[model samples]
Structure formats: C-alpha cells, structure tokens
Target: MEEYIVSLNDLKKSYGSKSVLDGVSLHVKKGEIIGYIGPNGAGKSTTIKIMLGIESNYQGEVKLFGQDIAEDSIEYKRKIGYVPEIADLYDNLTGFEYLTFIGELYGLTPQLADYKAKNLMELFGIGEVYHSRIASYSKGMRQKLLIISSLLHNPELLFFDEPINGLDANSVMIFKEIMTQLAAQGKTIFYSSHIMDVVEKISSRIILLNNGKIAADGTIEELKQINQEGSSLEQIFNELTGFNEHQAIGAKFVSIVEEM
Candidate 1:
C-alpha cells in the first residue's frame, strides 16, 4: 500500500454566508508532485491556508503523515515547508540575518544555520549581497532568499504558491530542476501556479479547482483526452473552468479602449 503524506477529507471553510471551500477532499502520496491550478477566487489560497494550519476555523479534517494536524500543530508544521504567494519578510534585516533567524526557529544550531544559509545563498548566486539589507534587494533576490529559507530545514513535504512570480528565466529553470530533484528524493510537493506550461510539464498529476470545488483531477494526458483531441493543458483548463471566453473579453476591452 502506498503511504499518503497529506490527506484532506470533506474539508469545508466559510465566512458567514460566503463559502470558500466546499467539501474538498484529496490525498497526496510520498514523492508526488501535484499541480494545484485554479482560476482566481477559486479557493486555492484558502485551501492551502487550511492545510498549513494557518486557518483553524474551517470544518473538516487535515492529516499529515497519518496524524491529524489539529492534534499537534507544531509537529505537523515541522514536517512541511511552505512558500507563500506573497514574499513577506523583514526588510530591515540582511539576507543572512533573516535566514539565520528562520533557521533558529526550525531548531538548527547557530553555526550550522550560518553555514547552510551562506552555502545556499552562494548556490543561488546571492552570496555577494548576503550582508545587504533586504530592503536593498530586488524582488527576484528576495524571492530567492525566501526559497532558500523554506528548504534549509529539509522538510518532508513542500507547499509552493506562485513560487516563480519574481524569478527570471534562468532562475525559473533552476527552480524546476530543484523541484524535480526533491521529488526524486521522496519529498511530496503541492505546487500552485498560473503558468500552465510549466505545471503541465512538471506535475505527475493535476487538480483543477473551481467555485470552491474540484473540477477535475487526473494526469495531464488524461485531462487532455477528456477535453478534446490534441488539447493543450491551457485549453483543457479553459474548458473545465469556463474561461474560454477570455479572448472575446479581451477584444471587447480593446474596442472599448479605442473608443475612449
């Protein structure tokens, strides 16, 4: 039997009368790279927040490594690394200082934390600016620091939301390679992104969410077969999510702009 590292059972979240996630359920096995794609406002971030134990008011059960997350939040969190969509960091601190702080939080010794932080920064080509304040770094530089911090502890599972937002082409390539290697080492990854091509190429399986529900879940080839012959992941996504009218919407906006 395959061991599932993460499981969500009939998960539901709401704010008053507004339903953000409605009976969402899924299971991820070890070494699986799941591409979690959805249109904006489709509850992707909400679901992630619930899984990471950041939102405790939701209804349903989330288990990590066969243990209920609510039973022990600290232990659950210790087994996972998360890279949120937003790069929220202390701008007053230098890159090295920030990473060292994160390392300490994860229970690493000061000497080991400093060594790993410096080595990782060197790998990402940011060692030269390690002493510079985060406020002085570019967006891409900050993102690199964030990625390093998330991976410094070598968690068993990773959750990445729009991780390629500020990365250049070369850095994006490097990031993809790193993800592939991590999966090969039996690390489970939940990757959420708007870049269909990258997700289609990298994900072992894809899950499409819409209107607080899972619209489709399958391999890329399976989803394409369900949509149409020779359909790309983008086309399959559009068909499932009712976003095929975007081109028409864009044209209408252009015409309206011209009149203005």
Candidate 2:
C-alpha cells in the first residue's frame, strides 16, 4: 500500500464563533486522487485552505508529506501545487509571462521556468495564447493559464478548488486526463467540486463533508454499499449529506415560480 502523503487529525476552524470545520480528519495516499465534496457551507474549502497554509488561524493537526504543516508551513507549501477558485493573474501579462512569474516565485531559474512554462502551455493546449495578454483571454483561457501556473514546478501534491468551474467540456476532459496521468506517476491530488459525476469518474476515493464535519470517506463502491444497489453518485451524495432535503424544496419553489 502506498503511504499517505497528506493527513489531518481533529482539525478545527472557526470564523469568530461561526464554526467552519469541526474535528475533520482524513488521509490521502500517495498517487491517489481524492475528491472532496460538500455543500456551500460544508467546510471543504476551509479544510483545503488550512492544509495549504492560507489560513493560519485554523486549529488542527495537518501534515503534508508527513511533516507538521503548522510548524513547517513554508517547507510544506513548496511541495504543493494549488489552483484556487478565483484566477488572479496579472491582466497585462501574457500567459507565458504569468507562468514564468509563478515559477520564479518558487525560486526556479528563469530559463528553466520559461521552458517548463512553454511545455505546460503546449501540453494543456494553451500554446496559442502564450503571447496574448491575459486581459484579452477568455474565461477558459484564464483557467488554463491558472492550471499551468500551478503545475510548473512539478509539485508532488496538487490542490484544486472547483477546477472545472469555467472550463469548456473538452478542457474539462483534458484536465481529468492530466490528473489521472499525474497520479499514475505517483502524485497526490485533492480537489473540491460540486460535480458528482466527474468526481465519481476520477476519484480513487471521495470524502463527503456536511455541516462542518466529515460525513463519509471511501471509494465509490464503498459509498454505494451505504445504500441499496443502483444508487447513483448524486443519490448517495444527497443521502449522506442531507442535501436532498434542500434540493427538493428548491425544486418545488421553482415549479411554483414557473406556474406563475
């Protein structure tokens, strides 16, 4: 069995009495792609932020590459590739320039960084936009740029938050393919998304968070066994997180609005 590349124990976080994460624990094996799913306020992103060292106020035991993140944050962060929900690239910079900047931030040599940036742009089918200023790029192009920036350093672990939010269908497929390929080469990936079908397709395991705590953790088949046969990913997700209740009410409200 592969060793765990990331682990959390009794993790807790709160935003001034509004508890965001409560006693969440998880383990991600090396080379495994783990999908983190939850509702809007379910603490998925909070946990990810804590792990990334973006939120120091958080209280927990988070280890990256078996090193305590709270203690060795800078060192731990160097081993991670992160793609945030929002793209914050410099609009005036070309795609290639933006990636080179990110690479430099990680202390890479200019020539090596540029070379890696060029290769990543070509690999992700974004080479055509390499010279175009980010301000002129479309949403999909920006997302592609963000992805390339996060990956330029070849980090051992990748963290993506809603990675497919603005991607086209083809781009989404490419992203999924790249993720699996990376994992096959002994990289760990942790991503958070509301899209159940994609998670079911790509993740080696899924961790469902509900109301600031972990609801379930297992493979698709293991989660499926929690309910009867033939249960879909969406069905299992709603059943475990109790999200179906709100969804049903929303559906009825939409129906009533349509009648008017």
Candidate 3:
C-alpha cells in the first residue's frame, strides 16, 4: 500500500469579501509527480500556502504523511520543501550563507549544510557566485539559489512553483532530470507551473484548476479524453480553461490606436 504524502479535504480560504479557494480537495501519493496547473488568480498559490502551513486561517483539513497538519504545523513543514515563485533572499547574505541559514533552521549541522549547499550550487551552475551577495545575482541566479536552499534539508515532499521560470534550456533539462530522480527515490513532488509542455513531459498526473475549481485531473491521455481533444496538453488546457492567447486587451488597444 502506497502512502499518501499530501491529502486535503474541503480546503478553502477567503480574504475579506473575496473567496480565493472554494472547497478544493486533492491527494498526492508517495513518489508521485503531480503537476498543478491553473491561470492567474485560480487559487493555486492559496492551496499551496495552506498545505505548507504558511496560511492557517482556512476551512477544512490538511494532512501530510498521514498526520494532520493543523495539529502539528511545524513538524509537517520540516518534512516539506518549498520554492515559491518569488525567490526572495537576504540581500546582504552570500548564496552559501543563505542556504546554510535555511539548513540550520531545518536542524542540519553547519558543516553538513555547507557541504550540501556547495554540491547543489555546483549542480545548478551557480557555484561561481556562491560567495557573492544575493543582491548582486541575476534573476536566474537568484532562482537557482532558492532551489538549492529548498533542497538543503533533503525533504520528503517538495513544492515547486514555476521551478524553471528563469532557467535556460540546459538548466531546465537539468531540473527535469532532478525531478525524475527525486520521484524515483520515493519522494513526492507537487509542481505548479504555467508551462504546459514541461508539465506534460514530466508529470505523472496533472490537475487543472479553473475558476477556483478543479476542471480536470488525470494523466495526459485521460485529460484528452475528458475534453475530446487529442492534440496536446496546450490544446487541452486552452479548450478546458477557455483562456485564449490571441484575444488580448493590449493587442486590441494597439490596433485601435493605429487605426486612429
């Protein structure tokens, strides 16, 4: 019997008059690479926040490793790794220092943290800037540092939001390889991204969220069956989410200005 690493039931959140999540439920099993896809304001981040115990004021239950997260938030958090969209880091700290700080917070020894940080920085091709202040790093470099920090603790469950956002082709390929390797090692990963191609190529299962609700959840073929579009994940996404790229307000505005 496979263990469920993450389980949510009727998870919901609201801010003032606006409800961000509405009865969202999901379950992730051990060694599963679940790709969570949704457009802007579709409540994807909210769900992740709740799961990570970053936002506790929500309705419903969250469980990790078969233990209730609400009862033991810190314990559950220690077992999970998170890399958010905005890779915020301490400007004054060097890349190595920042990673060391996070590892210590997770109870890793200073020497061990430094060792892991060095290897990860090298693997991500950011070792040259390991001693540089985070403020001096580029967007891609900062993103890589953040990923290294997340993995320093060797977490059993990982949450990645746009993990390859600023990465180049080679780095992106490396990340995909790492994700596959992690899954093969019996670790569960929750990947959230707007990149349909990456998700299609890597995810063992995909969950599509639309209007704060689950529109589809299954493998690529199953999703195609649901919408009857066998083209690709991109086509299935557009058809199911009803998000059109061609119809843009900026494009229409520019056209009107040109005509005038």
Candidate 4:
C-alpha cells in the first residue's frame, strides 16, 4: 500500500443551520505539492483549519502521519507548520524575537532557534532589520517573516494559505523554487491560494473546492485533458466554477467610472 501523509474521510463541518464542509475526503501522499483553490466562501479555509487541528466539532476522521488527529492532536502538531491567510503578529516584538519564539514553541532549543533565525533572516536579505519591530516592516517584509517563522523548526507537513500574499516578484520566484525543492526532499505541501498562475506553475496536483465539496482534483495535465483543450488554469477555473461574466462586469465597471 502507498503511504499517505495526510488523510481526510467523510469530513463535515457546520455552523448553526448552514454547512461549511459537506464531506471532504482526500488522501495526500508524501512529497506531493497540492495547490488548493476555490471561489470565496467555498470552505477552503475551514478545511485547512480542520487539518491543522485548529478547528474541531466536526464529524469524520482527519489523520496526519497515519494517526487520527482526534486521538492525539497535540503531540503530532510538532511535525506540522502552517501559514494562515490572516494572522496577527506581535507588533511590538522584533523580528528576531518573534521567530525565535515560534521556533521554541515547536520544541527547538532557545540557542538553536536564535542561531537559525539569524541565518534565515540573512539569507532572506532581512538581516539588517532583524532588530526592527514588526510594526515597522512593510507588507512584503512581514509576509516574509511569517513564512520564515513557519519553517523555523523545519516541519514535514506544511499548510500555507495565501502565503505569497504580499511577496514581490523576486521573492515569489524564490519561494516557488523553495517549495519545489522541499517537495523533492519529501516534504508534503498543501498550499492554498487565489493566484491561478502561481498555482499552475508550482502545484503537482490541484484541488478545487466549490459549494462545500471538492469540485475537481487532479494534476494540471489531467484537469486540462478533462476540460477545454489548451485552456489555462484560470480559464479552466472559470469554466469549472460556471463564471462567464468577467467581460460584462469589466465593461459595466469601466462605464460607471467614466460616468462622472
């Protein structure tokens, strides 16, 4: 049998009368870079939250490293790293302080955490600002800091939700290469993003969630084969989501702007 690093079976989550995740089942094998995409409010974040063990109260099983999370969520978390879509950083803390804190939380010694934080910042070209407060950092800088923090302890399973949100082109290129290299080293990456182009380039497989369920899941080549031939990932996304109003919407918006 093939080994799976992450598995979800009949997963379901609801808030009050409305359902968010209506049975999501998936098996993520080791070293696969799975790009997760969906329209707004498609329960993408909820699915990731469940896998990270940050959200419970759902029905079904979520297994990471061949063990059900419900059985022991805390212990297994040491092997995982997550960069959420939205997170609040400690504005008063310096970059060095914050990253070391995260590393320590993941079970690294204080001395090792500090040493690694310094080297990573230097490699990322942010070593000059290591002592600067997070509040003083630009959007891209802060985003980079978060990414660094996630990898400080070198977790095997990574969940990065919109991790490249404010990254510059150069940073984005480096990150893509880093992701590929990590996968080559047997790291399992579940990356969620709305940027179709980047997703197309980096993902070994793509999973589209729509209406509280997985709409499509396959390699980019497989997705292309099933949908319109010679279509781009963005085009395929629109077709799969039944979205054809872009031209109309753009014209209407431009007309409204010119009305004044």
Candidate 5:
C-alpha cells in the first residue's frame, strides 16, 4: 500500500458566511508532484493556508505523515517547507542575514546556516548580492533568496505557490530541473501555478479546482483523453473550469477598441 504524506478530508473554510472551501478532500502520497491549479478566487490559496497551518479556523481534518496537523502542529510544520505567492521579507536585512535568521528559527547551528546560505546563494548565481540589503534586490533576486530559505532545512514536503513569479527564463528552467530532481529523491511537492504549460509538462498528476470544489483530478494525458480527441492541457483546463468565453470576450474588446 502506498503511504499518504498529506491527507485532507472533507475540508471546509468560510469567511463571514462566505464559504471558501466546501468539502474539499484529497490525498497526496509520498514522491508525488501534485499540480494544484484553479481559477482566481477558486480557494487555492485558502486551501494552502489551511494545509500550512496559517489559518486554523477551518473545519475538517488535515493530516501530514499520518499525523493530524492539529494534534502536533509543530512537528507537522517542521517537516514541510512552504513558498507562498508573496515573498515577504525584511527589506532592511541583507540576504545573508535573512537566511541566517531563518536558519536560527529552524534550530540550525550558526556555522551550518552560514555555510548552507552561502552555498545555495552561490548556486543560484546571487552570491555577489549576499551582503547587500534585500531592499536593494530585484524581484527575481528576492525570489531566489526565498527559494534558498525554503530549502535550507531540506523538509520532506514542499508547498510552492506561484514560485516562478518573477524568475527569468534561465531561472525558471533551473527551478523546474530542481523540482524534478527533488521528486526523484522521494520528496513530495504540492505545486500551485498559473503557468499551464509548465504544470502540464512536470506534474505527475493534476488537480483542477473550481468554485471551492475539485473539478478534475488526473494525469495530463488522462485529462486530455477525457476531453476532445486532440485536446491540450489548456483546453482541458478551460473545459473543466468553464472558461470558454475568452474568444468572444476578446472579440468584443477588439470591437470596442475599433469604435473608440
């Protein structure tokens, strides 16, 4: 039997009478790269927040490594790494200082933290900026630092939300390779992104959510097979998410522009 690393059972969340996640259930096994894609406001961020223990007021059970998250929040959190959509950092601190601070929080020795920070920053081609304040870094540079921090402890599970947001083409390619290698090493990755091509190519399985519910869950080939004969992943996604009016909307926009 395959061991599940993460499990969500009938998860639900609401904000002031508005439901964000409605009876969402899913299981992620060890070594699986789950591409979690959804339309904006489809509860993707909400679900991730609950899983990461950022929001605790939701109803339902979330288990990690066969342990209930609520039962041992610290232990559960220690085993996972998360990169949120927004890269929130202390802009006043230098890259090296920030990473070292994160390492201290993870209980790493100062020497070890410094070594890892330097090595990872060097690997990402940003070692020259290690001593520069974060406020001086570009979007891509800050993103690289964030990635380094997330991997500092080598957690068993990684949750990445729009990780490639400000990355250049080369950095994006490197990130994809890193993800693939991590999965090969039996690390579970729960990736959320708007880049359909990358998700379709990399994900072993895809989960599409709409209106706080899972609309499709399968491999890319399976999803395409379920749709039209030659449907692409984007097509399958559009069909599942009910976003079929793009062509019409585009035409209308063009007509309005011409009238103007």
Candidate 6:
C-alpha cells in the first residue's frame, strides 16, 4: 500500500449555512511540497487549522501519519511543525528564551534547543538579537525567529502559511532553498501563500481552492493545461477564480485617489 502523510476524506465545514469547505478530499505523500493557494476566505487556513487541531466541528476524517486524528492521535503532533500566518509571541521573553521554551514543549532538552536556536539565529543574520527581548525585535527578526522555532525539533511534516511575510529577499531565497532541501530529504511540506511565483517554483504540486472547494489540483504543467490560453500560474489562478479585472481595478483606485 502507498503511504500518505496526510489524508482528508469528505472534509466539510460551515458557519450558519455559509460553507467554508465542501467535501474536500486530499492525500499528500512524503517528500512532496504542496502549494495550497486561493483567494481570501477560501478556507485555505481553515483547512490547516483543522489539521493542526486548532479548529473543530467539521465533518470528515483527518489522518496524519496513517493514524486518525479524530480518534486520540494527539501524539502525532510531535512529528509535525507549523508556522502560522500570524502567531502570538511572548513579548517579555528574549529570542533564545522563547525558542528554548518552545523546544521543551516539543520534548527537546533546553541545552540542545538553545544550541540549535543560536545557530539558526546566526545563520539568519540576527545573532546579535538572540538575547534581545522579542518586544525589541523588528518585524523581520521576529519572523525569522518563528521560522527557526518551527524547525528546531526537526519535524517530519511541516505546514507553513505566509511563512516569509516579513523576510527580506536574501532570507526569502534561503528559506526557499531550505524547503527544497527538506522535501528532498523526504519531509512533507504544505505551503500556503499569496505569492504565486514562489509557489510555482518550489511546489511539486499545486492545489487551488476557490470559494470553498478544490477547483484545481495538479502539477504546475498539468494546471497550465486547464487554462491553455494562459501563460503563468497567476494567469491560470485568475481564470480559475473567475477574476480578470486587475487593470480595471488599478485604474479605478488611482482615479479615486486623485479625486482627493
């Protein structure tokens, strides 16, 4: 039997007749970097929150590492790492202090976690801020700390939603390479972002969710076939989501601004 790192069967969610996910089914294998893309309110983050056990009251089965998560499989989380779009940090804690604390929660020794955190911070070019309080760190520095914290445990599967929000160009390049290397080593990665170019380059497969369901799911080349008239993923996305008013919207926004 083929092994799947993540499997969702007939997943559905709603809020007072407003459907967020409608019969979504998927199976992700090891060593695959999946780009989960969609417009705002498309349930992209909702699906991830479900997988991470942060949300509930949905219909369907969610299995991780071949164990049903709905059934007392909480221990499976140890093998998973997640970097959310916006996460709360302990502003009072220093960078190293917070990272080591998080590491301990994941069952790592304080010494080992600090050592790893130190090296990661140094590599990201924020070594000097290692001992600085998180409240004093800049936005980009905090983002780098979150990225490092997620990887400190060396998880087998990872979920990254807008992981490079505040990273600079160089840091973004390094982060992209890191994802490629991790996937090459048989780690699964589910990356959700609005940045189509990064998704196009790093993802082994792309899954597009529009409104509340999987409108498109396939490799980059295969998805291109869906929109044969289009030239890039962005174009294909616009077509799949029934959107092509970029120029019109831009012109209108400029005119509105000039009216003032």
Query: Model 5 clash tally?
Result: 0
Tell me each candidate's TM-score. Answer: 0.96, 0.93, 0.93, 0.98, 0.96, 0.98
lDDT of 6 by residue, 219-255 (tens): 9999988779767889999999999899999999999
Tell how far residue 69 is off in model 5, in angstroms. 0.8
The predicted structure with the larger TM-score, 3 or 6, is 6
Task: For candidate 3, list the clashing residue pairs, or say none.
Answer: none
By the TM-score metric, which is better: model 2 or model 4? 4
So what's the TM-score on candidate 3? 0.93
C-alpha lDDT of all candidate models, in order:
0.91, 0.86, 0.88, 0.92, 0.90, 0.94
**Which candidate, 2 or 6, has the higher TM-score?**
6
Q: On a 0 to 100 scale, what is the lDDT of residue 98 in model 3?
A: 89
Q: Which stretches of candidate 3 lie over 4 Å from their true place?
A: 245-260
At residue 98, what lDDT does model 6 achieve? 98
Candidate 4 lDDT over 1-260, as tens digits, reads 87689999999999999999999999999999999999999999999888888898999999999999999878888988889888899999999899989988988999999999998888877899899999999988898899999899898999999999988898899899989999999999999998999999999999999988998999999999999643889998998888989999999999999996
lDDT of each residue in 8-120, candidate 2, tens digit only: 98899999979999899888888989988988999988888888877878776888898888679688777889999975779999987888888998989989998988888
lDDT, candidate 1, at 66: 91
Task: Report the number of the highest-lDDT candidate.
Answer: 6
190-241, model 3: which lDDT tens digit per residue? 9999889999999999998887788889998888787785579988888888
Worst 10 residues of 5 by lDDT: 224-233
- Candidate 6 local lDDT, residue 225: 81
